[model samples]
Target chain A: MAEFDKNMDFPELDAYFSKTSEAADDRMALLELLKRGAVAYRGTEELRKKCLNARELLPKEYRYLEFAGLQKLIEKCKIFDLKNYSRELIKCIIIGVCYYTLFQSIAASAVIFILCLIVMVGGGYMTHRKNAKKLETYYNLAVELRGVFPELELEEDYCSEEKLMSLYDIVQANELTSLESAVVKLKAIG
Target chain B: MGKEIQWLSFKTREQKQADLDEYTRWVFKYGQPQKEKVEQILSRLFPKEAPSMAMMTYLLGRDAYYGRYNTKKSSDRNPIKDMYDVLSKKRYQVPKKDIPLYMALIIADERVSEALDYPPDDVLHVVAARLMEQE
Candidate 1:
């Protein structure tokens, strides 16, 4: 058992030591038992309380720590989910345009046979070809819009909200047929 | 020759329109809110207003094109290089942290591939990489 003081910084510790001192004449025996049981229990309880406090301090959105969890949900129902599908389709189109531009450059080199051979060896050729054509078609349509509305420069920063909204409105207005419907569906979800 | 001219009947235009309407309404009710929350988080991190709708559409369209296909190698032309050149000429600067959000948002719309006037993925990747370097 240890000495206890009322004004001790650790009042709980003082109280514990005092109780152990009263339990036995042999200070060492009483101190040993209290050290193993009471001290350990208090320490564990304090740790648990601290952990809860830390968790409470986090933002409400981050409290759940559900970024990956939500992503999994989105991936699970992507196709039927209009927003997910729209978003994915847009990504696909962007990739397609990159591929098309690259292909056009390669085609200009007049090494058509070499390009064909390279594509044959590449596992993604089929998907790449499909996306390229689709992006080309979309680009053509967008150029036509540029002709109609000269002020809306299609070649400016691609991520501007104004540009996105204008394109969304264009798509919503059925300017590009099936593609327009798809854009509208994406906006609805986004 | 006469058999080839037959118009196939599936769902009527009215039924298709109704389906589209219901789908759009549901998306707006649930998906839009979540997307907005994500965008808010991005704005706080980047301290910039979200990109304009037209810009987003074009970007998304570009992303769609790249995401779906692989670029062909050319002797004098690199698709990624071209993207960097185009982006460098743009007036607005796209910070790095916000690139993922932009990609995610554009990809969120399936029609992005059809909406863009140019390749978006290469430019997005270049910009994102540049932004990451600063971080």
Candidate 2:
């Protein structure tokens, strides 16, 4: 399928649609995935609002970088996890614990390390890193925004801390496929 | 109270409150720390649980400038709210419905100035509002 290979940007999302069956089980699974995406999309909207508010209030020193990071996050929020590589992720974690347990045996530990790497790499750990990088840029931008109002934040009732920290955590804690779920949810809703 | 009269009064009060809220939201938004500072001082000066009325907004505009224009010479308190107790006086009582527009004029007036305590100048949206207000 040369045509399919050319068009499929997200191989993980492709896995979901590759199945031929329109069976109830598959339909339910898609719905569940879409629901996760919807939740992630809401998170994305909150982040976008923070970006806009900070962009407005603060000087433009970090505007380009902040906006760029925010743009990547917005895009990611639309495409995160679609293949459900969570099982593989869990396996990698288990193997990691075992690898540590057997680290005294260098040869065996190296083999285990290789296995873990293969599993993690296959499970879209690269995508996680890409997303994490985007999140770091946004966090840096937020720091710049916070720098603008150092004294104001010291007040007890100010909500800026909540806005910065909660949004950063939302971006950081989201699953790799969180955006994919959001895209599917939007499509289903539409 | 009669049902019709009570309902009308309630509606009027709600509409007035909504207008005040909208006006304050605008000031808070564009005015930045100056407006926020004014709000903080006013909230402290009043320290009442009563719902916001036009007097509070008017007092903030009338006082809270850098210096002068106050009965008190202490130099710390907002003159309009602290010296005059403008809200307590009956003549200064702005009609409920007119509070928002009235306060807008006061906050945005050319004579009023934002305190220079914070940096970057132009804390109050006075110049912007004056230009927009064409005054």
Q: Write model 2 residue lDDT over A15-51, tens digit each, in one string.
A: 3223322332444454454344334344344444575
Range of the 10 consecutive residues with the lowest summed lDDT in candidate 1 chain A: A1-10
* lDDT score of residue A33 within candidate 1: 32
Candidate 2 clash pair list: A37-A181, A37-A182, A77-A179, A79-A179, A79-A180, A80-A177, A80-A179, A80-A180, A81-A177, A81-A178
Off by over 4 Å in 1: A1-190, B1-30, B50-87, B91-135
State candidate 1's TM-score. 0.18
TM per candidate comes to 0.18, 0.18
Tens digits of per-residue lDDT, candidate 1, B1-135, equal 112333664777897689667744533344555445434433443454644542543343343334322344444343333333333333535543454335333323322222222123344345344333432
Error of 1 at B45 (Å): 3.0
Each model's interface RMSD (Å)? 33.6, 31.9
DockQ of 1: 0.01
Estimate the overall C-alpha local distance difference test score of candidate 1.
0.39
